[model samples]
Target: MKPSILTISACGIFTTGIAFAGEQHLTCPARLEPDAIQPNHLPAGWELHMLRPVYLTEGGMLHGPPEESAFLVPDNSTSRKAGKQTREMQHWSFDVPHGYTMWVYCGYGGGGATLKLFQQVTESATECTLSSQSTNGRTKEVLEFSCK
Candidate 1:
């Protein structure tokens, strides 16, 4: 059975209807960023796969196919790994507008990886600020904002 989507308004997080299957079913983009993968020093057979962007309204409703929806997919890459304790490093470039919620699902292939969202500095990749709050599902992360 397909999982149902439930949003927790107080926190802007989604919970699946499945008894204890804590994540939303989403796929990681198949395209790989060679430059990102090559430098990661990942194990053989592991590579950086991008996370596809899913947009939603602040009320947790699915948003649109914006004018340039194609660009939404594969904005950045994350390495495939086997444990949730570690998340491979990669620079992400997607931004959630001031009034929407965005969810990015990263399937590390073996089902284990912690997900977090960071705000990239305007000019430096290494300089970033962790979001004040974030919600992590089994293989996904979400960021939300209130409409002004």
Candidate 2:
């Protein structure tokens, strides 16, 4: 039997990937369009590649190595300090076309308890690098990759 996909939309912002109902090949949006009004926004012709999950264990641990596409670096500082949980900050560094500034951010779920708005951050393109901070294990944060 083929697995079913459960897509959750948020005010038409972005669509969630296929849910892991049983056993299925999950895939999310590959790229994100550049927006001018958006901070840390990339210029035209740049698309952010979304990272694919390697394996989400029952313990809420995201295990995977860095990929050519995009990957998150491991950061469990806060988790270590608080003695609660260990959350890793994802860092991605990939090659760009030729000339374009790279931008990184932790978007879509960080802030007030009631209002969960997306947040973004800018990074210098030393060699086309992007990154995301620790997550709350909710899978709402997005780690983008691209150059502007």
Candidate 3:
């Protein structure tokens, strides 16, 4: 099958559904800057993927009530703004093929932050969600992607 290309605008619009074959590309919003992240580091044949957003609430401070839970669609202006405070919090989804490794580069504050890549045991049409494990106290950051 021919490769599929998917692009997401800074305004949070997706051009097309993800395609599993060939090379797939993902475009970051204009608001985001390029940092240390490089897509060339990813394994071969890996393509950029996007997924729906799911939000969960955690219990507030000691003896505090549970925080409100929210679901994000990742397809509008509001959801993008919510991630402004912490770029990592902004949820990005990707469909990574099994046995393939993808590289994600992220920055926080003045110093650089580390991202831990986790593999989801369950696979659904190669759809997987991508987010920062932590923003490292940085209000602004950049994300770059490259797939093999």
* TM-score for each candidate, following the candidate numbering: 0.19, 0.23, 0.21
In candidate 1, position 65 carries an lDDT of: 25
List model 2 lDDT by residue over 35-139, tens digit each.
311324557888554343222111111122112213234333122222433443333343444543232222232242221212121222322222222234544
- Pairs that collide in candidate 3 are 37-105, 39-146, 44-148, 45-148, 46-148, 49-93, 49-94, 49-95, 50-93, 51-93
Q: What is the C-alpha lDDT profile of model 1 across 21-122, one tens digit per residue?
A: 322222223222322222245589886554543222111112222222221332243444444432333223444555443333322233232221111112
TM-score of 1: 0.19
Q: Using TM-score, rank the candidates from best to worst.
A: 2, 3, 1
Residues 61-126, model 3: lDDT tens digits:
011111221222432111233432443333334455455433222222233222211111122322
Question: Judged by TM-score relative to the true structure, which candidate is superior, 2 or 3?
Answer: 2
Candidate 3's displacement at residue 8, Å, is 10
Question: Which runs of model 2 end up more than 4 angstroms from their true locations?
Answer: 1-83, 110-124, 127-148
True-structure RMSD, every candidate:
16.7, 17.7, 18.1
In candidate 1, position 44 carries an lDDT of 92
